[model samples]
Target: MDFSFPKNERIKSKKLMEAIFTEGKNLNNFPLKLIYLPSDFDDDTQFKVAVVAPKRNFKKAVDRNRIKRLMREAYRLNKGVIFNNSERDFALVFLYLGKEMPDFQLMESKMTGLLEKFLKKIANEEAV
Candidate 1:
């Protein structure tokens, strides 16, 4: 597995973001709201993810950046489980929804659980 989260697999395009908001399913645990859609890329080695914190929740840019950084760090460390699995190429957007800033460990745990649930959801959908 290429441990890198490359740009091509990322959901950066405005069209893809709109599709995720309008077409993809939503999943959440605590501080995270996940919006995802399966990628057309057939490669089974890498996935792309984006972390976002709404300006409404965090009025200050610094706070939003901090939260996004923490979210990315958590995802980076735990994403190995997802990349190694058969369903590797996907576009995932993670939004931080909670009002208050959460500790890194707490956010990490929530991110990990959400990713596991995401993997299971994909597998189940493929099975159908």
Candidate 2:
């Protein structure tokens, strides 16, 4: 199996996104916070992720998109660490909490750190 999170498993449904905000489990690590709710997709791939940036903080769509793009890229590159754990698909939503416009370098570092924390959390959960 390819131990990578592909685009198909990503959570993009509007209803699913709403449900995650209302009922998803929360996991936080500094500039990033994750609201993960079990996905409806029945597949074995370990996980899927959606990245969100607040519009209130970033008044311009360009800024919002840039941050989201950086976040997704960072997650894509680092998430292999977690995906290697399971063949089952998991749904995840990454929400940016910082108010200011963060540079790509800061976003990349924070995102990597957050991903590492998330991977550890998943490992710990599975061990229980």
Best by TM-score: 1
**lDDT for each residue of candidate 2 in 1-128, tens digit (9 for 90 to 100):** 44345777587678878888888778777688887766557555457678989988999999999889888877776776666654545678988989987787887788777767766776777789
- Candidate 2 residues lying further than 4 Å off, grouped into runs, are 1-6, 43-45
Per-candidate count of clashing residue pairs (backbone under 3 Å): 0, 5
lDDT string for model 1 (5-70, tens) is: 556655567876787788878888877989887666544425557788999989999999999989
TM-score of every model? Answer: 0.87, 0.81
Off by over 4 Å in 1: 1-9, 41-45
Considering only N, C-alpha and C atoms within 3 Å, which residue pairs clash in candidate 1?
Answer: none
Model 1 residue 55 distance off true place after TM-score fit, in angstroms = 1.0
Cα displacement (Å) at residue 51, model 1: 1.2
